[model samples]
Target: MADPMIALATGLSAVLLFLLMIGLTVYLLWKRRQDMRRDNQLISTNSVIPPCTPVLQTLQASSYGSAEVPFFLPPSFKSSTHSAMPEGREEEEQWKQHPHLHIQRGSLTIGSWFPLGSLRPDLYQLPEEPSEWAQPSGSTVRLCFAVQYQQEQEQLVVSLLQAANLPAQCQSSATLVKLQLLPSEDRHHRQAKAQSKGCQPQFNDTFVFQVSNNSVDQCTLRMSLYSVDRLKKHHLVGHVLLPLRQDELQEAAGKVLWRDLETDSDLPLSKHGNIQVSLNYNQSLQRLTVVVLRARGLQCPSNAGVSVQVSLQIHTQVVKTKCTPETRGSTPTFNEKLTFRLLPVQLDAACICLEVQQVGHEELAEVPSTRATAPVSLGLVVIGPFMYARGRELEHWNEMISKSQELVKQWHGLGAANNIYNNNQT
Candidate 1:
């Protein structure tokens, strides 16, 4: 009974002490949490802030429209203050504007864009057919021909045709017919005889060709009509081209197709003239020697002399020489030799052109007739780069190259001036 007061005071003192200690501990924890929250808010705010450097800002603005803030911020920072931040809200709006900036949940795609692989059809739906044909498959066909022509301007056309002076002519008789196969390495050709001069000449002929199924796509039958001359030089009159179509081949075993002939639009009518030349290359002397021997059938008017102007060309270099004029009504023999200094390698692109011209001389008062004026071109001949010429020109080139240092003489036909000059100029 005497210690009850003392015990009550002691219990009250212990309870007060325990309460104070708990209050202090709670206050300290609350302050620490507030500091941590402030620190986290600062970090989150700073993370969204753009850099101060102009270069960085320019790069960011160019690519992303603004500074890029990562979406995967710390969980504590995000749950507390992310939504409350103005920077964060602005970043969210930017990401919404450019949806490509967000991490999509499923398949990612550009706007309205699809992969090319998805456009391919299923392999099972493809058609079944051989892409290439088998080899050594072919057929044979026989073709027959008949020709008839009408003469216009009558005897004048015949005289022009006989002269071979004009570029165009109309004649029926003295025609020779030939058949040729196209795209064949052998250049298979056949011919029929000439008919007598008449208003209407008729020809009945036949030809056979070995055709292949694989080759029919590229094969063509060419029939040409020519006017034969006394010099054996055949002038092209007209021609016709027939492509071996599949329908034609199916019914062409013994077909006789009569088709009208048309003028050969591609053939260039050549004037009657010729130039003879000799070429010799001397390795020891480092020189190429060319001899202008003679010119025949030149178109020279009366009282005019014919002369030749020879030009040698290599790359862009040109060397010119001339021959003395010969009297009219005589076969002009130039016998003029022109020499060019060139190395063996330079001969690869070397060529020569001869121009036949008519020169006129007029005697003046007390002046000798040696003064010549007004030269007119009759025809031209070009013997060239050797590699590009065919037939006689190629044969002559081969002969000259095979027998170097020795002269090789050959006669080359001359055509219109435009033919050779235009080609070589380019």
Candidate 2:
């Protein structure tokens, strides 16, 4: 009886110990799972609120000036009615609902939770008034003008009028006027004959330009006045630019308009000078030859002579050969030749620039002697790729390129240094 009782006690003790071990194992597993879940929740919270960098914060602050621009809560932070829905699908739905946030300029405020504010009046000022010529209106524009007296110039022996301003100073004894439709390369242009020159010279001659209704906004009527010198070179006196819009055209259509001629900023009121050049290309030798022939209408101080130099540039490659300085005079003749070695493949991208510079004098004497000393900048003319040439320039280039190994000579006009090249590129 004693032995059986002892055995039962031993069995009960073993069973109790086994049950305790199993309970301990289950508690350990549950605690680990709770810790993992807490960690995952912290990670998701961090992802929802991204960290802002210093640079971005500074940019936002500077953009608002001293104004307190509010920052509204993102869609993800906004209260939602569907909070009970599945987590993954709800986040996606919130993003889809608020696809874009429209924020007006200077409306952003700092620290405030609401994005409600009127745009600063100073920040949202209206743009500048557009030019009358840029207005888009479909109305026929008729431009009429008469060449009136030009004030200021003393030597007015002969004069010519033109609707279009010539690139180089005109070297023609005959005074004539030319008018052409804008942006068209056609040969349809109007002209008027040359007339004798005088202060307040009355042209009394009236001309008209008929612009299309659609193109009236872009059309500009240019009136150029040229004086004929003893050498028969047409020196540019001055020009006037008339914008042809519907309102201005309608108001001035029947009435004769007289306005003062405005000279180019670089060119003097009295003509400075003009350079003449001849271009020839030899296909067989792959050489380009340029001849600086003569310059006319050069203005100089009393008893002071002018010296001139010519430089030829193809792209950035400048020719080592520069023409020798011509004799001191208002009109100097160089008759020097400059040659450049080139290949057929290079001509497509080549641009020829001829720069005529005035040397010898420390400063160019301004007219009337009271004005400040001005630097001498004679003029520059450029001949670009064949495809880019126009009118007479195009004709000249075609003639040269067509005749292989033969010299093709033509007179080219020069304007203020860099003006022709800059205008062409623009």
Candidate 3:
């Protein structure tokens, strides 16, 4: 038979162990509740406020032509004393009633041209000369200089042309203008006559200019230089339009005749995220793309995990084209809808990449990303152990959030839920 005292001791020990377990359970419940509250606070504080429809500032100022230019000078120089070396005169008379003329001398040595290197096209102009017979005061004397280049020859061919596409606003006031080019050969001969010497391959040369009746309102020059050797590895000079004049060059203005935006070219979305970008056409591929990415955790959606939602609004250009068939007797109309999509993401801001393409050539990229995407969100995932042990705590949190939401809904419902909710009275 067992001793009564021993039995009593065993019973007491078992009861104590049971009580300890209960205390641990209560403590754990308290901690989980606290953690959940903190998480809720964070989520509430960082809640996503759906972005308002973007007021696109893509009213690109009317553009006409690329305004970049490349100008090159020789690597070395030797200063020669002029009979009357006038300095600072060119600077003073550059903006006077008429252009002040000065003559300076230098030589440029030509090496193999880089296809698109330092030397660039500053500008071109064709001025109308006042006929000796016609004594007209100031009729708009427009000058248009067309610039082209020989890729292989490394020569710049400038010609008198019309800016058929030039904007009217950029046109100058009616006045007389002079069109001229400094003859390189004449300079060479003059130097020869003065020096009393034959031509040695002069690598550098100086130039002189003299003006009588008219002023140089705006002076621009574009020089296109490329590699002289076809096989040598060299830099290809990208075309540039350098403005030599101190003031704004009127020729730099242009217009965007047609623009297309592809709303669907946005990048993949990450949840609870937002993105913002310019609404415009992509130049390279003639397409647009917006992109957004976000990080989400492993929390369960229903119980202990955080899930983020993403939202997007899309805008695109509607183009109607009437292609006149050269072979047919009529103009055929092609009706096309440039379709785009704004994908929804959860948790963080979204980055929407946009792309614009013709229906058949969808594979080719039309443009690079204009900017990063919008309406971002971030997600978090919690382990199941936390959820399983603290299921009641999660329930409690949901209950509280649900109650708050319900109150808001009821309040809004009474007022018909106008967006602003500015009305103070019930």
Candidate 4:
């Protein structure tokens, strides 16, 4: 009984000792965890904190009392942050003042909602239906040349002195000057030799055009400038038209005269000239005879020849085309006859289109083919019944139809070729 009591007491004491040890360990661990948490909180509270940065901000009110709003840009701006803020503020103010204006790819545009594409600015707009003689829009041309007429020699001399301030395109090519004397029967005109490629070319070359003393004052001097490349390509730059008045020529003889080059839209229109024609129809032979008498008050280049082209058209399709021999001068006489075969009933539907064209010649034989030097239409005259013709043209056609085999002669005014064709199209 004594041994059992001692053993039991010892076991109970050992169990209590073990429980106390576990309680102390748990307390220590809890205290350590609480201390670490407090230290973290204290350190975080005492440390510095940065202010929040906004992606976008509102600037001061503009003079118009509108809120200026900055564009939403990330804080990591590409440029310096300090500089970006001022630029943004200025831009924001400008945008608020002008809602229609906006910056696009660094350029200030007139519209904000839509982007501009292939649109020309208002500053470069040109007039609609600009006159042929109107000053060209791009860089202008200026020419320097001299004209002299000697009474004793009965000869007119033209000297191509120099050309200044040529268009920039001429820098890659050689320049030449073509000279023609108006109202003179010079079989062939003269052209100066091509000079070195430059914006300013000096050509002291002189050309002679024979003119009688009686008609010297009635003559005019025409000068045309051209650019020719090494590949034999030709480009007409501009023209200088100078009338040879006796007094002006005498005062300015051999002295270089500077003139601004004018546009080359000098094709002779209907208002610029007139043409006479005679028509006769033979009912028995089923043929139409048209005689081109002559043309007067025409305007053409000096180095060009004039001819009349007659086209017989049934609706939009042309049946036949005939042209007279090319003649020189503003007033030329053709007196050539062109005949077309057709039934009498066909005359009601058939129309005739006459076009006076100027054929230009290039004196330089080396440079052969280019559409730039092709024949230019000077004027157009159409003759037919009713819808195909008007006024004098209609009367002429009616007269010919009424009196078969009887010649009906009339004068017709010239007009633009496109205008005449469009008016007569089916």
- Top-lDDT structure, candidate number: 4
Candidate 1 residues 1-426, lDDT tens each? 869999999999999999999999999999999999988976675434333211112122235466754342211123233466676564554446545423341122222233323442454486767632111122211123422111221110000011111122334336666777665578657776533444334454444455655555455566776776666778876565554545434454332343334442322333657777778788778887777766666666555687777777776567555455454555665655677786778767776767787766343244334433545567777676654467676777667777784567667777766323334546
Hey, what RMSD does candidate 1 come out at? 26.4
TM-scores of the candidates are 0.32, 0.31, 0.13, 0.34
In model 4, pairs of residues that clash are 270-414, 270-415
lDDT of each: 0.55, 0.50, 0.26, 0.71
Worst 10 residues of 1 by lDDT: 153-162
Please give, for residues 1-426, the per-residue lDDT of candidate 2 as tens digits: 999999999999999999999999999999999999988986675423443221111112345476655554432332446657776665465446533433322344222323457545666698888643232222222122532221223111112222222223333344544554444457675655544433323343545444446665554455566666677666666554444445544455343443444444423332445555567788778887765655666555433443334444455665543554444545565555667787877776565665555444445343334322322456655665665556555666666677664345444556556322234557
Candidate 3 Cα misplacement greater than 4 A, ranges = 52-426
Off by over 4 Å in 2: 1-272, 301-321, 364-375, 386-389, 418-426
Residue lDDT tens for model 4, 1-426: 999999999999999999999999999999999999988986776433233232333354466768785653223223344354676564454457544334322332433433455443765887689432233234557777778888899888887877777888887788888887665566566888556667768788888877788887556677888888788887898877575657657988856667667542533336757887878888899999887866876766644688889999887789999998887655676666789997888887888899887766444355346644555566888899886888888988988988784457667888865322334543
Name the regions of candidate 1 deviating beyond 4 angstroms: 1-270, 325-327, 361-372, 386-388, 418-426
TM-score for predicted model 3 compared with the true structure: 0.13
Query: How well does candidate 4 match the true structure in TM-score terms?
Result: 0.34
In Å, residue 37's CA in model 4 sits off its true spot by 99
